[model samples]
Target: MKYLETYRLTNLPAKAYYIPDFISDAEEHFLLQKITNAPLSKWTVLSNRRLQAWPTQLLKGSVLPTTDALPTWLDDPLVQRMVSLDIWRQSPHDRANHCLINEYEPGQGIMPHEDGDVYHPVVATVSLQDGIVLDIYRKTEDGKREIVYRIYQEPKSLLITTEDMYTDYLHGIQDIDVDKSLYRDTVANWDFLSDDTKQRIELSGGDLKRKRARVSLTFRDVKKVRNLAAFLQMK
Candidate 1:
């Protein structure tokens, strides 16, 4: 984790990094286009959001299909850039083997939850289109959840969660169009954010109003994979 110390989010957990403008504006548009123009069959529609799994969705047993590697649209410079950070040095694959693209509409969000052990603990997330606030909590001995920190993710940015940030805490976004109670004190990565980004939030009177849709590209390495041909032959 020392390799990534420069981009670390020290205000929150032991290991998490937020890189603003991680991708150029052009790359952001490229990914957003790929998501929006993808075939309807590719999307897995859920109650609050929709998702697309590259290669294929994981089986019920948390097994990934070995039919094909992730498409170029899902890999390329993003994965290469992450590899340089040395976050996945201990993963089974040593690189991301799966990707889940999630599209969230205004006022839609998932509940606080852990990523679980089916995959490696490291998560490299890239945000596109709009911004949002992620709230993190730690479970106490009394079984109560305490809000420990908050992260404001902006478009074209990268958020990497590993170590304590990935294993010991739960993270989620609020299901509201407006995110209030903002400032450098509230957001864990405030000091790392660009000055213009901070001003935009401050000028809005500490209220971040969601005005557009957002899509997240979450990359992780699954621990188990079975070749599709071999799996079908067993049946």
Candidate 2:
């Protein structure tokens, strides 16, 4: 696939790719099953969303103790496709070593924040189940922030953020049951969405109602790692 031509979000920042239908419905179903079937303890409950970190969460944001790879269910075709795209080729490890699975029920969204410095400055997010609008903000010199753009992420779509988009902007989803003002002018990737999605938004008179749960699989390469012995010794 000519990725540049097929999935480009040109108006936003230096780099952000929105690939609709990146995964098949069957694949999405399988992934949801795997996520839901995982042992309950694997999920770390946050105030707004619950998450499961693969290969374990970083130790102090700078160390990974396990050499074990991501589970086959998570890695197989998806990771392989991501690797083929070569988005992470320049990253330290040349591939993502971690996956953060976050589940957000309707009306639950994360606060506006950057991904921070724990990982390579690139993120590949796969949305499942439902779609939501991710608001991007710019911090002003006076310390206030303003919503500069919004991207609607659809189910089974791949949203890749890199370079300026990943490093310079704060991205988050609003905790609203309905997303208003959705139209060609308000949505950054409006031109790239599927016709059906666009029609639904238009039919609602530019307001998109939110329903169903949404899950995001965020893949990144953590910059730190340590063997188990070294990790234990530090403790």
Candidate 3:
């Protein structure tokens, strides 16, 4: 409880907390293996990235129709630990009901977007394999998006965004291999980053070049859920 405050991104807008080394190397390996070993049909491959949604994808109405619990691999330690941090205290289920695994290769990224209203206004993202810079933007009157903040998420880190930051702003990553000009004044979470991470970036001439593949486990709670089997039987 008290340790969470130490990892808060105080300089950022509304609420965003970054915790480095949130998972151990063994846990990271275990999660990655589980994701890789899942059924091939479980993956939803896009042009830039591939995603795996636990239980199942949402129905046409943006509702979780399966009503099944997340697999054991996603339950213990990770989700359990997240609750201990007090991030999901106000969520509808008081815990995460949905998990989205997004895998990104170097030079690939998702477009800036909001999580929308289907779920609660909170996101717990766990980064694995590589570090990346997440850019937050505010929409301008001229229909252009202006970068407001940049968060550097290291591997095995947990980043939480809630309240205004989750609902008001747009967040996305750049399609580049290296995040350049990473200085204390530019990166919002610089002050909260571990000294080892800072030095590694500095050693690279103020840039963080993504290495290997990276996957993120984004945990959220879907407000609406239905029983697909029951609905089908009734139909």
Candidate 4:
């Protein structure tokens, strides 16, 4: 994470970085186009959101089926830039092998949850189209969850979470149409956000409304990969 020290969120638990405008507008447009052109079957429509898993989904919830690599549209620029940061140097694969594309509508969000053990602890997410507030929580000894931190993710921004931030905390987006109280104290990465975004929130009286859909591309290294072709041949 040394390459990302400049963008590190010091207010957070331990190792989380937020980079504003991580991708150029052209690159963001290209990614959105590719996602839109994907086959309808590629999208898994859930109750709250829709998802697309690149190189196909995992096998039995843990092992990545090595039938194909990440497509060019999904690999270049984004993952290549992450490689330059050397964030995955210590991971098992030394690079991300899978990506989860999630599209969330206004007032739609997932529950607080840990990513589990299927992938490495390092997770990098790029937000597109809109901004949202991600609430972080910790579980007490009594098994109750409490919010500890909040992260405001802007469109075209890159957010990397690892170490204690990844292992010791649970994260989720609240199911709401507007994010309120967005200020220096509430958002962990407040200092890193663009001035325009800050002004927008301030002028709105600390409330930022969600007016459009937001798409997130989450990249991670799957720890296990099994040969799908070999398994099919055996059967």
Best by lDDT: 4
lDDT of 1 at 162: 90
Q: What's the residue-level lDDT of 131 in candidate 4? A: 97
- Candidate 1 or 2, higher TM-score? 2
Q: List candidate 3 segments past 4 Å from native.
A: 229-235
Can you tell me which runs of candidate 1 are displaced by over 4 Å? 1-3, 229-235
Tens digits of lDDT, candidate 4, 78-138: 8989989989999998999999999999999989999988989999999999999989999
Better of 1 and 2 by lDDT: 2
lDDT of 1 by residue, 100-214 (tens): 9988888988888999999899999999999988899899999888888999899998999998888999988778898888888888888877888799899998898988888
TM-scores of all candidate predictions against the true structure: 0.94, 0.96, 0.95, 0.96
Task: Name the weakest run of 10 consecutive residues (lDDT summed) in model 4.
Answer: 226-235
Which regions in candidate 4 have their CA more than 4 angstroms from the true location? 229-235
| lDDT of all predictions | 0.87, 0.89, 0.89, 0.91
Clash list (residue pairs), candidate 2 = none
For residues 4-111, write the lDDT of model 2, one tens digit per residue. 446878898889999888899999999999999999999999988899999677777667776767888888878888989988889888888899999989888999
Better of 1 and 4 by lDDT: 4
For all candidates, the clash counts are 0, 0, 0, 0
lDDT, candidate 1, equals: 0.87
Q: How well is each residue in 1-235 modelled by candidate 3, as lDDT tens digits?
A: 3578788798987799998889999999999899999999999999999999997787764778755888889989899999998888898889998999999999999899999999888899999998889999999999999998999999899999999999889999888899889998999999878899999988998888888778999999999877887666756
